[model samples]
Target: MTMSISVNARAWMAAGLVLVMAQASISFAQNSKDPIPPKAPAYFPSVANQYVVRLNHEVPALRTSKAFSGIEDRLGASIKEVLRPDLVLIERRNKETRTSALVSLRKNREVAYADPNYIFQALKAPNDVDYSKLWGMSNVGAMVSTKRGLKGVDISAERAWERTTGSKNVIVAVIDTGIDFTIPDLAPNAWTNEKELGGVAGVDDDGNGYVDDIHGYDFVNNDGDPTDDQGHGSHCAGTIGARGDDGLGVAG
Candidate 1:
C-alpha cells in the first residue's frame, strides 16, 4: 500500500526535500577560502554596534542514497563552522518547546549574520482602520476648474502643506500600507536620497545604520527595507507631495 499525506503534510515534505537539496548545493560550493570577503565596519558607529544571526536547524534525511552520504558530512561541517562563531546557540530541550539564545557581541566586532533577502518577505498586517480620510474634514470648499467650471475640492492637503512644509522638514514617516513606486507622477519625486542604504542581507552592506533602506525605514520590525504592503503609503505620499496644476489627482 502507498502512504498518502494531506496538503499541509505534503508542503512540509516538500520543504524537507528542498532543504536536502540546498544542503547538497552548499556542500558542492564549499572551498578552502571564504566565498565573501570581510566587510568593512559600518560608517555610522552608533548603528554598527549591533547585529543578528539566524542559524539553520533543518536535519538531513538518513537515507542510504549515495548522493545523500556524499554531501552529508560536508553539510554538517559547514553548519558546525557557522555555529562555531562567537555567539550563543539555543538548543531545544523537548520536541515541542520554545528556546531563546541571546548573544551580545562587542561594539568593535560584527555580531550575527542573517540572510538579507529575508527582509523583503515581511508579512503585511491588515489595517482595516481608515484613519487618514476618517479623521480629516471631507467636504471643504470649491475651486475654479478649467474643465468642469467651479467644483468642490478636498483642500485639506493643500492647507496642511502650507502650514507644515515651510516651517519644518516635515519628514512625514509614512508607516502604513504599501505604495506603488512605479507611477510616473509619483516616481520622479519619490523620496530619492543618496544617503539611503541598500542590501540583500547578511552584513550591513551600506553602513547607513539600516540595511536595504533605499527608500525609508520600517520601524515596525526594524531594519530598513521600508517598501509598503498596503496602499496607504502611496496615498499618504500623494497627500504630501502631489504637484499642483498637474491635471491629475488632487494636489497637496
Candidate 2:
C-alpha cells in the first residue's frame, strides 16, 4: 500500500512544530540579571559632591553589633542610596575635594576608601516603548508607489520583529545632524537619559562630565537638546528606528 499527505496537512504539521519551539525559546529567555531594582533613595541626591561605593564584600557581613550601621557621616561619607550589595551611592565631602569618586570599602572598616581609578555620579533609568508604522515592514516587496516606481529595496524587518524589535541596552549614535526629539511623532521614541533629565537642567546628572545631555549633545549650539536645526538628522533617525506600525509615523 502507498500513502500520501495533503498540502494542508503538511502545513499543519509544520505549524505545530513551530508553536512548540517558540514556547520553549520563551522559557529559556526568562533570565534574571539584577534580580530586583533597589528601592528609591530616602533623600534627593546631588551628583556633584556625591560618590558611588562598591566594596569587595557586603556591608552587612562586617558589622559587629546591632548598633553598627553601614556608612556614617564621621567616615566623611553619608549613605544616600544602596544600589546593590557591593555598591552604595553616597554623598562625600572633604577639604579641597568637591567632586565624587568610586570607593571600595575594606573588609573591616566602615570608612570609604576612594579609588583613584573609578569615578561616581547620579543614578539613572531608561524606558523602552515603541509605536510606529512602516508599510515596508510586513511586505517590503511591494512598490514604493509614492515615487511612482516599482522597487523592492526591503530587508524583511517584519520577520526579525518576531524575535526582537530593539533593545534599550544598545545605543545607536547617528553621527549626522541632530534629531528633533521635540516632534510629536518622534517624542516617545526619542532617547533621553532618565538620570540627567531627573537632575537640574544645567547640571550633569550621571557625571561623565557632560551636563544636561538628556537627549544628545549639540556641538554646534554648545548646549544640550540636539534638536534638528538641519532636517538631515531627523530624516535619518526616522529611517533608523521610528517605531513600527504606530499608524502615525514610518516604521523604524
Candidate 3:
C-alpha cells in the first residue's frame, strides 16, 4: 500500500510541474514584443536616356554590325558616342526608361557590363565668414544652432600644428572648377611659374605648349587663365593651403 501511494504522489507532482511550465510560456508570449523591420536603402535615379556599355570583346564594327543593330532595335536604343572599341555610350528611345534599358543591356550575351551614366557633385564644408565656423578642423564640443558638437571629433589641427604648419615646397593642384589665385589668402600660397611670369606676352613659356600659364592652365576654356568661374575649386584650394598665424580669416 505504501509503494502504491508513493508512485501516485510522483505522478501528481510531474503533472503540476508541466502545468506551471505551460502557464509561464503563455505569460512570456503575451509580454514579448514584435521585432522591428530594417529600413530600405535610398534610391537615386540614373541620368535620362544614357547608358555606358562594355562588350566581352572588342566589336570594331559596332556601328555597322547586324547583330548589334538587332539588339539596339529590340531595346529601342542607339549609339550616341564611341568611347572605346569595346565600350560605347548609348541613348535609350523615348519609349524606354533608363532602368529598363540598363536591364536589357545587362541581359545581352555579347555585353560584359552596362550601367547608366550617374552624375557626381563636389563635396565640401560650407564656407563661413568666421574661423570658428570651421568646425571640421577644430571642434570643441560647442553647440551650433540645434546641434551640439562632440569634442575630439575633428582633424586635430591644433596637435598637428605643434609639429609643423605647412611647407611651401609642396604644390597641391586643385583640378575642380578652377582656383581663384587672386584671393588675398590664396594669392600668398599660389604656385607661380617663373618662366611664364617672366616670359613675353602671348608666348608659350618653357615650351609647355600653354601660353602664359603663369599660375595654371584652364583646360575647360583651353586658355592660360585659370580663374575660378565657379567657387568650388577656390574653396578646395583655401581648405588645403590657406595662410596660417597671420591674424587672417581661416587657416587650412
Candidate 4:
C-alpha cells in the first residue's frame, strides 16, 4: 500500500531509528562475545593468618571443651595457643577461610568476640636501643618484664621531633635533685659554664658569686659542682635532653 508521509515525519522516524541503534550498540558492547573481563579482587593488609577468639565467660576449660573442639573442626581451624581460660588463638591457612571462620565464631552464641591478629608497628620511630621502653614518647603497648601501658597514651614526641628536635642554644635547666652531666647521653647536651671552666679552681669566674661552678652549683651542699647527688636529677635531665639518634642509649 502506498502511503504519503510528510518530510518532517520521515526525518523523525530516521532519528528514532538512530536512537534505537545506539541503545542496541551499547547493550551489545556491555555483553560482547569478546567476554566481559572479571573484576580484580580487592587487596587487604597482610595478617599473621591467625585470629584471636574470646569465648564467653561461661565457657570453661576451652582446650578440652567438646563444643569448642567442634567449632574448631567445623571451621577447619586449629588452636595455635591458649592465651587465657576463655581466650584462644586460631590459625587458618587461607585468608578467605580465616575471614569466614572469624565471621562464624562471632555469630556463635558461646563466643564473646573474634578478631584477626593484626600486626602493629611504629611509624618512623628512632633507632634508639630502648625506644620501645619509652612509653611516654611513643607508646606501642609494649610489655617490659610484666608491665604494659595503654597504647597511644603518649606525648607524641616522635611526631614533635618531625618538626624539630630542639636547639642546643635553648637551655633547659633541670632544677631537680641534681644533674649528672657526666653520662655519655647527657654530656653532649649538658649546659656548661664556660667562664667557670676557664677560671681558677678557687676563684669565681665571671664573678657569678660561685667558685669554679664549671657545670652548675650544688645549692644543697653549697658547692660549685652541680653533679647529681640523688640520681633523680640525672633521670630528669636525660628525659629532657639526652643525645638522640646516637644508637648508644634511649633518645631524649
Q: Give the number of the best model, judged by TM-score.
A: 4
Q: Write down the lDDT of every candidate, Cα atoms only.
A: 0.33, 0.45, 0.58, 0.58
- Comparing candidate 3 with candidate 4, which one achieves the higher TM-score? 4
Ten contiguous residues with the weakest lDDT in model 2: 11-20
**Models ranked on TM-score:** 4, 3, 2, 1
Note the clash tally of each candidate.
Answer: 7, 8, 0, 0
Per-residue lDDT, model 4, residue 107, is 84
* Pairs of colliding residues, candidate 1: 116-200, 116-201, 117-200, 177-230, 178-228, 178-229, 178-230
lDDT tens digits by residue: candidate 2, 24-138: 1000111124332332332322245554455444545444533225344434566555555556555565532332233323322643333221221321111113221233433
Which residues of candidate 1, in runs, are more than 4 Å off?
Answer: 1-170, 197-206, 219-224
Candidate 4: tens digits of C-alpha lDDT, residues 126-163: 56677677788778888868888789998877655533
lDDT of candidate 3 over 132-163, digit per residue (tens): 76677778788899999998788765544433
Give the worst 10-residue stretch by lDDT in candidate 1.
13-22
Q: Give the winner by TM-score: 2 or 4.
A: 4
- What TM-score would you give candidate 1 relative to the actual structure? 0.32
- TM-score for each of the candidates: 0.32, 0.41, 0.47, 0.50
Q: What is the C-alpha local distance difference test score of candidate 1? A: 0.33
Question: What's the C-alpha lDDT at position 240 in model 2?
Answer: 61
**Model 4 worst lDDT run, 10 consecutive residues:** 13-22
Please identify model 2 stretches exceeding 4 Å from their true place: 1-151
